[model samples]
Target chain A: MELVVFSLLNGVLYGLLLFMLSSGLTLIFSMMGVLNFAHASLFMLGAYLAYQIGRYTGFWPGLVLAPLIVGLLGAAIERWGLRTVHRFGHVAELLFTFGLALLIEEVVQLIWGRAPVPYTVPSSLDFAAFTLFGTTYPAYKVFMVLISIGMFGLLGLVLTKTRIGLIIQAALTHPDMVAALGHNVPRVFMLVFGVGSALAGLAGVIGGFALVTSPTMARTLGPIVFVVIVVGGLGSLTGAFVASLLIGIVQTFAVAIDFSLIDLLARFGVTVTRADTFYDLWRIKLAQLAPVLPYFMLVLMLIMRPRGLMGTRET
Target chain B: MPIIRRALLGVALTLAALPAAAQDSIKIGYIDPLSGAFANVGELGVHHFQFAMDRINAKGGVLGKKLELVPLDSKANPQDTQIALKKVIDDGIRFVLQGNGSNVAHAIVDTLSKHNEREPAKAVLFLNYAAVDPALTNDKCSFWHFRFDADADMKMEALTNYMAKQQGIKKVYLINQDYSFGKAVAAAAQAMMKQKRADVQIVGDELHPLGKVQDFSPYVAKIKASGADSVITGNWGNDLSLLVKAAKDAGLNVDWYTYYAGGLSTPAAIGQAGKDRVKQITEWHSNVEAAALDEELDAYKKKYNEDFYFLRTRNLMEMLVKAFEQAKSADPVKVGIALEGMKHQTPTGEVYMRADNHQLIQPLFVSTMSAGMKRDVENTGLGFKTDGRIEAKDTETPTTCKMKRPSA
Candidate 1:
């Protein structure tokens, strides 16, 4: 029971963190139709900048300042870099961002070297928030959950309630109609791209504290964000949220349940012979398969629900 | 017409002298991961190899030929290593050094041993600096391959020997990166612990994916719940550092026995998280007071801007030079014969390659990190203090290798 509770809680926290990064990509992909391959690079930049800022001014200020710097830089990237590449079509824009991701990784390594930086949780939030069934949970984890929920709420309010948010939504469904009605579609596209990047930056600031702050943080988190966005349907924010939690919970639960395929097959009266050449394949437990579970969900979602769980339009 | 003919003759003579100029130096291939997740450790090792050669070159050329190190990036992949090996062989280099991943080492050893069998005249010697897979020196051992670092079982034997004497440590947890090397460590530790201290309970055993985990908090949570008093792991690089950091943040104050505690950037990366609790089993630590290698150590550290990490790398170069001097030839076959049973002196102690397995038996140290360290890497303001030293003779384990030597 304790295992179930802890795994679910941690899984939700992890899913929320994924949502924090995936939400921006969802908006940008849905509104702008650009995949933003370097989105995770911006996430890495935020982590590295936060690590640098936290080294001087402390974590609280780093929390505020790092994302702002990344957000502004992101806006500049949309304004100057992506806008310039927009003329070359989506394929070209994706290639540019991919190249940019490699360059950003090199730059990070050049500055920080190829090892993990000591970007630890601050002493104030370093202690456990509370003990659960004799297990201590760090306060920083709760802080991550709070910040992710807060961002989701703010994003929800901005997309659904505000005037520009209404325009972005209208553009999502009826870009031609909105453009025909004289809305500056390019401006809306840039806004979505910039705002989406800021969210990823925010995710990085919190996630770095949760993980190791290193040049490859972006690479580590890059594929999972895509899995979340894709499994949620490319453009559906709510679907991304649902997929995030679903995938997160499923993966977390998979890790906790240590059932081997051979052991499982044995219960059904199928014995695994030691002489089998491929015996090692059957030896893998669910815990070892946890990392690949998200991708399995990805493949299943693409085949079964191409439009995603709650997706309005086909992706 | 006579003047033009004389100019052509001069050009031909100059071109003829080029191969001789190259012949005045022996080119050794140092192949390892240079651009991947393991690049930091690989690059550190390359720097050590280059520095070791510089020291050898200063003392006059070995066999009157300057030892030149040719570095090639293997990208930490076996296929890439094979391609790199072929390229080096094609270039007439008969010796290669690599030591980050045992997978890469296996690829090199297999490729080179096959090459040596197929073409005895062009046989290449694969000198290992730090891949500690027991199979390399045991069942899967190759005649053309020589390991300069102690195998995993030897290090674990030394480690568990020290572990047996400790007062506490009722319950122990075994955690490692899920791979061949990591699995070997866990299997070896479990067997040795059972042999040494049957009463100690192995409360938890887990293997996480290698280099893929972003958060070790859940894993650390599991460790805390296991009621473990001591944790043993073979994790290195960022994986090891993150594990230590997570344990510290969660206030799990268990003693950690690790394989890569003093690896590149790890000790510093752990910082205050592992000041006194983290311990490592290694051939040499930077804090060891070795007066003999002081001058070389000072100059080497100054050039690299980081403390020397791999003592086996230094031993490799020093032994290679001695082999050349004794054999009086730069031929790979002759050098290989000389290196098989070579006894070389490192600053810590004298070590010899066991003739049966080609495993270097060197003095091993069990050390821990703390402040006011006499020596530190990355200015971490920390140093490793030795807890125990296992002499070279004490670390010998019987090998299962039945080497297939080339028939003369």
Candidate 2:
């Protein structure tokens, strides 16, 4: 019972963090038809920038400024870099972003010197929020969950109720029609890309302290973000949301299970010894394979349902 | 006519002395992760080696020649280490130093063993400073390879000995990174604890993906639910730091017995939360009460702006110089023979290279994190306080090495 409750809470928390990153990638992909491969690298930049700013102005100010700086940088990249590469086709754009990711990683290493920066949770939110079944959930985590939910609601309200959001949505499906209706379609693309990158930057500010702030941070979390988007559907924000939560919860709960193929086979009277071929494979517990489970699901999803859980269109 | 003759003789003498001056320095090839994810650790190892060499060179040099370090980037990969070894051999360096990962060490040992057998005259000796897998000294031991740091099993033997004496440690949980070294640590912890404190219950044993788990709350929640009094983990780097941070954030107040709680950025990451609760067993720490060594350590920090963590490098260099002096030769074969079963004295205690397996038998100290000490790591203001010290002989476990010696 304790495992179930905590796993759900932790899973939701992890899912929200993933959603924070995937939401921007989903927005940019839907709008530009170009997958921003440097999205995670932007997230990493936000964390490093926050750490640098936090060293001077404290966490609260750094949180506000870091994402703003990253968003502006992203906007500049869209205006100067991506706009220039637009005529070169999708592959060129992809290669450009891929090269940008490597550049960002190297530059980060150059500045931070390849060690995990000591970016920690603020002392204000470092206390326990509540105690359930003898385990005290931290206030920082609760803050993170609240922040994620608030962002999700704000994003939803913007996309549905606001004028600019409507224009952005229109630009996603019919940029020519939106342009014909006297809207600056190119400017709208820049705005969406900027906002998307800002969302990733925002995620990094909270996520960095929650995990670690290192040079390899982007590389480690990069593939998983793609997994979330792919499983959620290529160009679906709602799909990304559901997929993020599903992957998060599923991965969390998997860690609680110690069952292996060997354990399951023993119940059916099939004993496997150490000398048996692939004994190592049989003995590996679900918990040990939890990190790889998302990728495994990605492969399965590609095979079974390419459109993803709630994806409106096929990739 | 006499002036011209004298000038020609002077030119001949100058030409004759050039090669002797060129041979005045002995180069030792350093292969480790000088790039990639573990570059910091690899660089740190190089810093320690260079510092050791610099100090030795200051003291009239080793075997009448200054020790030169040739650092080659291994990237902490086995294949890259093999390439680095080949490059070192090609450069005519006879001594190789590396110690970040056991997998890389295994590759170096295997490749060097083949290279040494095929090219006996150009055989290179491997001096390991930190890679501490027990298999290196046991079943897979090599005569050419000498490890300065204590192996995982030996450290566990010392750690469990200290834990067994504590009455509060009843229900222990074991969490480690899922890899060969982690498995070895877990196995050693379990076996040693069972032998020492049979009544202590192992409430949980878990192995998570190494360096991959960003969140450790689920694992901590499990520990909290299990009502464990303490945790034994073989996790290092971010894995160890994140686990400790998560445990603190979740308000899980269990004692941590870790292998690397004091490594690199971990002290800063855990901060004051691990005060008096987290314990680590190592060959040496900063605040080991050796006055002379402490001054030397401070000098090292002043020079490099980094903590002197790898004390084994000091022992390795000192002992190697001793062997070189004793052998009266620069030949690796002679040095290898002289190093076997050789004893050396340091400020900490006496240590010896066990001839059966080229493993250094050194005293291991188990220390706890404390705040406001004379010396601190990573400038965190929190430092390690000695909890218990297991003598060199007491930490010794019988090895299974069947070493093949070269013909005398």
Interface DockQ per candidate: 0.49, 0.71
- How does chain A of every candidate compare to the true chain A by TM-score? 0.94, 0.97
Q: How high is each candidate's TM-score?
A: 0.93, 0.96
Residue B186 Cα positional deviation in candidate 1, in Å, after optimal superposition: 2.0
Candidate 1, clashing residue pairs? Answer: none
Residue-wise C-alpha lDDT for candidate 2, range B1-408, written one tens digit per residue = 999999999998998877654389999999999887888889888899999999999988977899999999998899888889889999889999999999999999999888899999999999998888888889989889999999888889899999999998889999998999999988888888999999999998899998888778888888888889999998999898888888888889999999888776778777777887889999989989888796788788899777889889989999999999999987999999999999999778999999999999999999999988888878778889999999999988998899988775
User: Any residue pairs clashing in model 2, and if so which?
Assistant: none
Worst 10 residues of 1 chain A by lDDT: A306-315
Worst 10 contiguous positions by lDDT, candidate 1 chain B: B212-221
lDDT of 2 at B397: 93
User: What's every prediction's RMSD, in angstroms?
Assistant: 2.7, 2.3
